[model samples]
Target: MIGLVMAGGKGTRMDAKEEKLLLQYKKPVVIHVIDALKSSNCFSKIMAATSDNSPNTQSLLQNNGIETIKTKGDGYVSDLNAALSYLHELTLVVSGDLPLLDGGIIKDLVASYDGGAWQSFLVTKKFLDDMNMMLEFSVNHDNKECYYTGISIVDPKKISSTNTIKETYRIIDDKRLALNLNTKRDYDLLKGA
Candidate 1:
């Protein structure tokens, strides 16, 4: 399996002078993500999915010896689809802003995944409540409530012409999976943690 870290978004929500991924938190958020992926020891290779608008992010990753693939910079799905097209095998997709992500969480996600399904890591409703994160959409899986954690195990070959996929697997209730830094508020919360 290969690892793909998606970091191409403009991060308008962050309203920062610099890219959100480049903002420091002990280290840049994207670097923390890359370290997590590397420490997991799960993937044969790891690459960043970036875009033209994010030259600094791309350059930073390349300087750190991580390969990067340019994407459309349109939207999450579009960039993800572009990255998928470049990858010909099963790829583990991770959000670049998830600084709290660690190797153990990635290991658990990979180990729990059933090879047949398009697996996504999810945090249980209780986990979100404990973290004081606003509840977004929830799905009833195995009769339990869970939310997307922005991590997925996708098979590039399974992507359809319209950039959609069917069938899903959920790995649930990992608190470490809840720390996704999208806005300044989320970053503040992470800092407080």
Candidate 2:
């Protein structure tokens, strides 16, 4: 499976002068995501999905010898679709802003795929509340609200045949999977940890 990092979002919620992926906690946030993917040893190839909105992010990864692909920067779904179409294989997609995510969690997610076309890693609202993370969005799952961890395994062969795709929503209770760096508050929380 190819490892794809989505790094092209504008990150308007971060309200920072620099791209969110370039912001440093210990090192550039996106690098942490990339390193975690590498440590998982899950992909034959790993690439960052970049865009015009994040030229600096694209340059940093490229300069460091990481593979990158430019997308339309229109929106998450569109950019993701563009990347999946180009990859044309089974892929593990992760948000570049998840600085705290680690390889073990990734490996567990991969192990749980069960041959589904897509498997989304999610966190329950209770987990978000316990972490004091803001609830940006959620969906009803087994009578509980679940938040997307921005991590998933996708089969690119099924990209055009959405109607026939089988999806699994795996709810993880780990804080590492819950901390998505979207806002200043989220960054501050990560820094304080």
Candidate 3:
């Protein structure tokens, strides 16, 4: 299994000059999520996918020994395509700004798979009802158009271009999927706790 990280967003919501993924919260932004994923022990190949806009970001992640896939564009989708184009195997995709995420949550997701195209699986706190908030983004890498998450055990065979990729599809029933630190307010809310 491979782990694909999308780290190319400009993080416009974050008012600070620093990028959201680079922001430090006890540790750096990406590190916390990376560390959690590392702890999951589910992925054999772990790497980050970034673009040219953030040159130092690659070096920073590389310094920690994580392999980097540098590409040529913006948009998480662009970085997603760059990473997925090469990885034929199933991959667990994570965004750069997730810090409060837990690796065990992902492990549980993989375990829940019954071998279908489980584009979404995992333990997400139910805020409203039966609708599960797929928080994590798993790239249906085989096809650039397919993407799903909140923790998922992917069957690459089932991922096809027929599936829709939403830019910011929210789940009112379970808002827990997006614990994104995209703004100073988000950062403060997390750090304050």
Q: Give per-residue CA lDDT, model 3, range 85-183, as digits (tens).
A: 676777777777767766776576556445554354323234212332223343333233222333344445455642543222212222233456766
Better structure of 2 and 3 per TM-score? 2
- Candidate 1, residues 1-193, lDDT tens digits: the string is 9999998999888889998899888999999999999999999999999997688999999999999989989988789888888888888999898888899888988887777437777777777888787434577777778888788898767766643456585746655678778788888888898
Give the Cα error of residue 2 in candidate 1, in Å: 0.3
Candidate 2: minimum summed lDDT over ten consecutive residues — where? 158-167
lDDT per residue (tens digit) for residues 1-193 in model 2: 9999999999999999999999998899999999899899988998989999999999999997789888999988789888887887889999999989888988888888867789888899998898898646688788889999899999887766656667779888888888899999999999987
Better of 1 and 3 by lDDT: 1
In model 2, state the lDDT of residue 52: 96
Clashes of each: 0, 0, 4
- When summed lDDT is taken over every stretch of 10 residues in candidate 1, the lowest stretch is 162-171
Report lDDT per candidate.
Answer: 0.84, 0.88, 0.61
Whole-model lDDT for model 1 versus the true structure?
0.84
Name the Cα RMSD for model 1: 1.8
TM-score against truth, every candidate: 0.92, 0.96, 0.73
